[model samples]
Target: MRRSRAADPRGRAADRGSRTVTLTGLVAATALTASLTAACGGGTSTDTEGGNTDPKTLTYWATNQGASLEHDKKVLTPELKKFERQTGIKVKLEVIPWSDLLNRILAATTSGQGPDVLNIGNTWSASLQATGALLPFDDKTFAKIGGKDRFVPSALASTGTAGKDPAAVPLYSLAYGLYYNKARFDEAGIDEPPATWSELVAAGRKLTKGGKYGLAVEGANLAENSHHAFVFSQQHGGDFFDSEGKPTFTTAANVKAVKQYVDLLAGDKIAAPGNAEYAQNQSLKDFATGKAAMLLWQAADTTLKSHGMKPGDYGIAPVPVQSGAPGQGRNVNSMVAGINISVFKNSDNLDGALKFVKFMTSDTEQKHLNSTYGAIPPVKSAQDGGTFSTPAQKVLRETLATSAAPLPQVPDESKFETLVGTAMKELFADAAAGRQVTEKSVRDRLAKAQQQMQS
Candidate 1:
């Protein structure tokens, strides 16, 4: 169900430099604080009434999404209230910035003091599971969430173990795709989005005249750079890792894709030179400001519209495919993305924690989340909600229908992405400096990656 090949442990957006979380939250319940601290020790002691003293209270930690998540909290709070009223339990929720979330979780896990239920990057599931701090999803737990069948198989796949019990339920799912500026396309006389790698190159070149860039891609950030390169590599028939979770980025397809990825900015001259130094914000700003005609982006169309761009001013499409490959129509690999839900093993409220997990990932909650934040719903049924306030959502959804594989799901994924990004940076830099993009140069760069993999 998780689309094994696409289960990239290094592929999620946070690592890719996509969005940053600016946290804004406060709780007015003193008694609740006391109960929580008392129940989960190992932190600076503080005195607050009812200090998590009650065993019936459940604490939840959610990563920052858009303001819509606050709305979700509002809806969920009432639902929790009803549950608590019936069961004589209390629910405490906290929202934290996504940037340092993993570090926070790791620290909390080590100290034995953290939320009972928490949201995490799906790719981090394996690493976190290694800590033995997560509760396995058994048959009883699965039933609490209306069965796993309600969610998209691919989304759920990323959340749990392939053969054993799952560590987490798929909360939401996302994929990457090409986002283009309609105004730029129209002005360039381009009528349709590119459908093949060849077309993409041609369109990019045509749109590159003038100071405007044809594409805006992040080249420095490991995840962003590697994901873009992965799409091209997969389209050309490259597989970055093997069944044993080993590095395999030096394949012929990878060589070709890497060349093309670099050429977009250096050889083809369709992308901005500054792209190598930019992250997600810079790329989005480039497209929004009309400095670039296209970019590979994740999530729904809400962010674009939020920038004051009209829906008709832009378009969405799947990453173009190579001429021939095993899955030509779906040759391109969009990074499988989304956060994972995990519970600390040391939590005293394991039962309450599991209940909250089931509630958050229920079919109903997924639909509302998808609708609220334009997040791709892990539940196939929930994915039917209204696309972002734009037709672009439909196009993006259609593109994702091919379901490009998730990124690598190895525990050492973060390190691998950095290696890929380093190779790309060197490749792009070499091309820009007038070096021949021969197989030798690529081989040399990849050799470094191979060496690192071995170490």
Candidate 2:
């Protein structure tokens, strides 16, 4: 879920670039926190006196989605002021860097000291919900914000565990796309963007002649690699987990997908040899600087411009599929969800927190915030209102509504990331070193990763 920093326009400057957490440590910490809360009489109470409906002030921890904390403050302060004018409740906004947000949230969960409301990566919804530290939006509570039917189905599905109350609601949305250098394609005489796996390889071969490789890949970034694996696997009719949330990384469909992905470097030779060391940022650089003819990313318009690539220089298209696959690989993509909003269960100002959450997801605010950050709004009405004016953004909006899905929703999501991402890193290394990356090798590594998860 944590793929590229650039993909998330939010200021993740504080994120250590890893979401890995030890399940044992988390359980121990939660148990200790619960014990302390009971001893101190600090847990949330169900009585009328316990729920503070009319608080004078509310604390909000916002993820940095702009150039800096200052930038986000500039964008959000006016909105908070509007909320105060309308509700007589002042919001104390604290912009937390991505690096520190998760740890801070965990500590807050244990200490019963946290902001009334906050923004979280959508992928963390299920894991956080499992903690029971978040305020669940049931039918009565959901009406205060908006009807559940108001949100995009795919985006809304990511808010929590399926068939249960979601711990959060979608605030912003994003999706994966294939970006290409139009000029390079024209020069290579490639009439259209590749629409299938075989076509992609053929196009890459033609685009490979010039010092530039045909495709830029983030082989070194495990998160990015894991995402690519998910996309490829989905195209092959496979999923990372079963319906019961058990990991299925060693499935035949997944093995075929991973082998095809590794083949880009090991077999097709479309990506550069050094790409094994490239992170998302590095891969973007390669494409922006004309070192590669194509790249796959999400919410890349802003970053592409920042890197000096012009609007006319690139074109956005749906990710290529395996044409020979069943149903022509329709509706398959890298699982995606953007940022989501959540309220802490232990907050004294529950009323103010819920109101703020609603206000943030309201059509006006969704448009304002997503427009400033260049991301797609999560609300169906906002998306339909022509909020995304750019060709790329529009494409992403369609992709989210039609094809995108949340990553495997399991409490061990962080563990899934580690196992799959680490395996991908090693696989890329082998390919870069010119080792024979057979299908058996790929399957064996996946089998080992699956075993570690079980152990």
Alpha-carbon shift of residue 44 in model 1 (angstroms): 13
Clashes of each: 20, 4
Q: How accurate locally is residue 321 in candidate 2, as Cα lDDT from 0 to 100?
A: 78
Q: Once superposed on the true structure, which residue ranges of model 1 sit more than 4 Å away at CA?
A: 1-56, 67-98, 324-330, 388-391, 399-401, 426-438
Which predicted model would earn the best TM-score? 2
Tell me the tens digit of each residue's lDDT in model 2 across 220-249.
665566667777888877888998988999
Query: Per-candidate RMSD vs. true structure?
Result: 7.3, 4.1
Task: Specify the poorest-scoring 10-residue window by lDDT in model 1.
Answer: 22-31
TM-score of each: 0.80, 0.86
lDDT of each: 0.61, 0.72
At residue 300, what lDDT does model 2 achieve?
A: 58
In model 1, state the lDDT of residue 40.
Answer: 43
